[model samples]
Target chain A: MTVEKISSLQNPRVKQLVKLRDRRPRDEAGVFLIEGFREIRRALEKRVPLRELYYAPEWFLGENEPALIAQAEAAGAQLFELTKSAFAKVAYRERPDGLLAVAPQWKRTLQDLDKIVAGSGGPGRPGSTTPATTSAVGAGAPDLQRAPFILVVEAIEKPGNLGTILRSADAAGCDAVIVCDPVTDIFNPNVVRASTGVLFSVPLVVAESAPVLAWLRAQGVRTIATTPAAEKLYTDADLRGPLAIVMGSEQYGLSEFWLKNCDLPVRIPMAGQADSLNVAMATIITLFEAVRQRAW
Target chain B: MTVEKISSLQNPRVKQLVKLRDRRPRDEAGVFLIEGFREIRRALEKRVPLRELYYAPEWFLGENEPALIAQAEAAGAQLFELTKSAFAKVAYRERPDGLLAVAPQWKRTLQDLDKIVAGSGGPGRPGSTTPATTSAVGAGAPDLQRAPFILVVEAIEKPGNLGTILRSADAAGCDAVIVCDPVTDIFNPNVVRASTGVLFSVPLVVAESAPVLAWLRAQGVRTIATTPAAEKLYTDADLRGPLAIVMGSEQYGLSEFWLKNCDLPVRIPMAGQADSLNVAMATIITLFEAVRQRAW
Candidate 1:
């Protein structure tokens, strides 16, 4: 098969790729654009279907672009070569790496996540809807058995903070990131960029907050919300066993719904006048505190 | 005193405020712009001299703007009222809160910090260069008296990350934040915005790495550097006593100079495909871990 070459800045394909930058077109078409060599490479590695791969050799930062292009082609992605100027016009990043791919958007529901979480434990319990017992693990729990460790964020408005939260969740080895009533599009190019391609590796679910809270109750996952008004400090809280760390939006702490429904509410001790940390930073601190506890 | 009113976007004062968005102009003029009601309020509370205050009544987000303007005026600021269009042209934030101020830049040296740190302890030893004992506090230290908990970052390129780090440092109640060879200007508007006004409260020092390291050594502060290659996990390290957490740039880990010079090199355990967390997130994780250990 011959690769299509487009040199004009006004090429129809370039216009479509540029249009993908906005949420309405991206959502309507049910697809999103992934830019940068690292992002495309991760997408291909995860076997995320690459509908089309666009390249401008002159814009590549390194020698690996050719191999990546070949791999994408072998994976059944249609190949296209754009002139340097054309690629520049379609790129979302300040410094485009000349590799951009259009991939179909995907979604996962709580039901889909239930299977994965249940399967990760010692014995296979695929499709089991049994609520996990609240006493599944005692304080100072043993680390022999794997438990569900999830992060739930509500109405996060900033794309950069959302992406960074995903990165932290990935680093802390979270089972999944559940975004409930998300204020920012998960597919926004900035989110992808800030996540550093971990968006593809991490299991992500987007759903409403009420159902997610209900689903967590059904899964027997203890929801722990971080708030300034909480009595117990995060470090003192028992974060072991099957758990979900719930975080709130940038402008507000956890919503009344999550705070009211969560099994435990904890606060990170703030020593300065700032009163609270950024949502992303707070998530990492809280997530790692749980990680530190579970390491036993 | 009658407050001056200007409606033209082309007014020389408005043009100068717009130019303050860039680093060179901000540094050359020895002043930087602070936008948003919260940031200006924090600046005023901290007694950061306000050279001028600019406001657009039509763009005010709340009824409290008039009180804030009066406070700034009483604090010796020259007030200017602008048309909404003029304020929009000069504002850095996407959603301006109808408040802006130009504050003169200030500097703090290691010598100055030495006085502050020495003063914060239970007893005053102002201007004394006597090195703190290496074993100021044993592992699992008590929280009776404060220790110098400083955050040192080298060559941070993004203004947003730099600002966020400052916010975290402030929340962690750090004694000071020493910036070494910073690539991003600390006064950049994005830094100010991302910091959410924590910039005014946090004691920030801009200096070179070698001297800061030397100052840390002279102060008997243990330097902790986080790297993926470290043999020790951050949680497992002894973080008590006077300490300085040194973070590297976003792209690169700590410089060889810092990595080789630091007392302890530890790593945050990463269990994901992504090798590391964002610098600001990592800094918070490590800082809070220290906060946890010291709380005991």
Candidate 2:
């Protein structure tokens, strides 16, 4: 396939890609920029829809860039060659890897998550005969027997923290991540970079807190809210079962709505003078505790 | 004590305070900026020597600001009142609480730590009658019988990550934090800010890795290095003993020197696509596991 070449810094496409850096344009246009080699690869691997691929030959360092570009092209992505200066204008990092992509924003709602979880053969009950599935069971219409272990985050404000949480969720082999009333854009460039591409690997859904909670209840998933005020220690909570660990923003924890609604409210023991842990750190600790209990 | 008032942003003291925002000035002058009401209070409470306290009357928010200021004054800290504009020029946070301080940078060596640990009535042998001490044994020279559970970090580059680790160390009730061969200053403004003044509340020591490892050996503290490449999982390690959990930077795992010298190498199990976790998050998870095992 012939790659279209664009050298001008003032190119309209470059200007549009630059505009996508801000949240409003990204929201209105329904597209976001994915930069760097790993992120683009992860997006493709996750089957996130790609509209265009831009690469500057001089700055491209990855040995597989040609193969990646070919793969994107085969998947119907329009490929463009960018000049170094032009790429600089559109690139987010100090040292751009000479590759970037404009991908359509994918939205997954609570219903989609419910279907995905239900289709996956939901996590087996403790002491049940059904074998525990360690792999994510989606994309192929999951076998309707596996249980789901979900992470619910309410109003996370920092893109970096959100991304880190996604990485942890991925590492813990969590089924899906539900973002509730996010304060920061899920597709924020920093979030993509911070998650180190785990954002694409993990199944993520965005929805309002009430709807998400209601859906989980319907799905027979227990919701555990983490709050500093909770009397029960996080370790004491039974996390091995089908669980949804709900975490709030660092500045303000779970709203009264969640505190009143969640099945359990637990606190990570804090022996320090500081009242709480960083939200991402707290989420990882909580997620891993479940992982430990499941012996997965 | 009379509170000196300064109104000009051009004031020499204001310029000096602003320069303290950077690491060079902070290191060269042997002092660091402690911002916000809580941080200033924590520093004073920790007995860190304070040279000056700056506050703007117009923006003061904390109800206990007067009491805190009086305490600082009683501790021999010179007090100054700045105009809003002047304070804004020197303040780091967008929503300043109208409080800041210049405190001398405190350094703790392995020897200091050795004395502190030894004085604390170091941890008794397993099955011994000596009860494990839950309190910090410093200030008046701890009874020389308690054992120390420490957290050792090597070459941590980001002030934010380092600060977060310190906060975790405090939360896990680790006796002290030793920053080994650090890339970022322990008293970095961001470290101070990110730690939320836990840097003051937690005893912190900065030393080279060689000396730190040697010191740990001398103190009879088992050194466990965390690396993704390790064969043993962190949970499988015996962490209830007098121990130090050593972690390296994200980009690079523990240096060969550390890896070769550490008593044990362990990895936190990763079950998903992400290779590893953010260093601070990893440290917290590992430390909390120890805390859980110790039942402290």
Model 2 TM-score? 0.83
| Per-residue lDDT of model 2, residues B204-292, tens digit only | 78888888887888878899999888999888888877889999986787999989989999999876664647788789889988887
Residues A1-296 of candidate 2: C-alpha lDDT, one tens digit per residue: 88889999889998998999999999999888899988888777766667899999889885889999898898789999988898999999989999999887766666656665676444322212333221331222233454578899999999989989988987887878999988989889999898887776566888889889888998889999999899999989888767899999878989999999999999988776656478898898899888877775
Worst 10 residues of 1 chain B by lDDT: B133-142
User: Clashes in each model (backbone N, CA, C under 3 Å)?
Assistant: 0, 21
Fnat, one value per model: 0.77, 0.66
lDDT of each prediction vs. the true structure?
0.83, 0.80
Give the range of the ten consecutive residues with the poorest summed lDDT in model 2 chain A. Answer: A132-141
Give the range of the ten consecutive residues with the poorest summed lDDT in model 2 chain B: B132-141
Question: Quick one: best DockQ, which candidate?
Answer: 1
Report the C-alpha lDDT of model 1 over B1-296, residue by residue, as the tens digit. 57999999889998999999999999999999899998899777666778899999999978999999999999889999999999999888888878899988776677757754564443222212333221220011112257778899999999988988988887887777899997898899999888887776666789999999999998889999998889999999999888999999999879999989999999988877545487888889999999999888
Worst-scoring 10-residue span by lDDT in model 1 chain A: A133-142
DockQ-based class of model 1: acceptable
Candidate 2 at B122: error in angstroms? 12
